[model samples]
Target: MRSTSSFFHFLIQKCNRKTRRKLKFSKELLVVDSTKIIVGIGQLPWAPLKGTRAGVKLNVAFHPSVGQPHRVIQSTGNHHDFRSSEELFDAAIINVADRAYAKCKRFDEYV
Candidate 1:
């Protein structure tokens, strides 16, 4: 936990040092998005939002270059982004997110 910055730096540095197998263009940066799954109110009563509304959300950040998931978070749908967002990286690896995330309170820190 204390070495978050160093860990991120080391990852980027290692990625940069990897040997390229062929002549092509690739993005080393990452992209992020969120999705939701609706669950029956009876199954997930803790996330209730009136009537039968209840669900959970998944936030993911992935590396475009290697097609690998770099970070992920899951939380009750009622809590929203602010409550579920975790620090994905310490390096500013050109994260591309939608405008909704751009306006979030903790979005600036990642960049």
Candidate 2:
């Protein structure tokens, strides 16, 4: 099996290339969301108390046009979904996102 970093790198490159080539003007829509994974550090100095722990976030960019996920991205735990929107989809592409991504700047710039 390939290393985790290598696999993710390949995925990112493939997604970027695909998005650049075929993400043209269409009546399609894309959705984005993130999932969190917790990691235990065994009482590290910077660890959160009680319930919280170090974690990784999986930020996904899904094309709802086909009723299946098209592309996905994984980011650090602290990265917000909107902060990576531009990198997830091509510029000016139509995207359908939840209220968390309804910022005016992103809508004005990429919608």
Candidate 3:
């Protein structure tokens, strides 16, 4: 398995380059969401909250036009979906998301 730091750095570099190349402003909208994955890293002493497991979160940003991902930000399972929205939106030319990401503040900011 790769170390956490190295994996994140690789992901950032890969995603940044791909985002710059693939994302185009053609009146196309993008979608943002997250998924949870179990990492099984054992228990930690300083956990964030109750009922949270040791896992990873996949924060995905994709354009609806071509159905391809533009940006992907990975974080701990405990990280909330909203926490990565700003970065995802900023990277996207147009942003679309599920009801789970329908926060008034984010919607207003995007507008």
Best by lDDT: 3
Cα-lDDT of candidate 3: 0.65
Better of 1 and 2 by lDDT: 1
Q: What is the Cα-based lDDT of residue 90 in candidate 2?
A: 49
- Maximum-TM-score candidate: 1
Instruction: Order the candidates by lDDT, highest first.
Output: 3, 1, 2
Model 3 misplacement above 4 A:
1-26, 43-52
Q: State the lDDT of candidate 1 residue by residue for 1-111, as single tens digits.
A: 748547554554444424323323253566666778787899989887658878888877877566578898887876565443446532556565655454555556546
The C-alpha lDDT values of all candidates are 0.63, 0.60, 0.65
- Residue 87 Cα positional deviation in candidate 1, in Å, after optimal superposition: 1.8
Model 1 TM-score, 2 decimals: 0.61
Q: Between which residue pairs do clashes occur in model 1?
A: none
Ranking the candidates on TM-score from highest down gives 1, 3, 2
Model 3 lDDT per residue over 1-111, tens place: 998657544544554444645875455456677877764445543433345556777889875445478789988778888878777775426575667666787557657
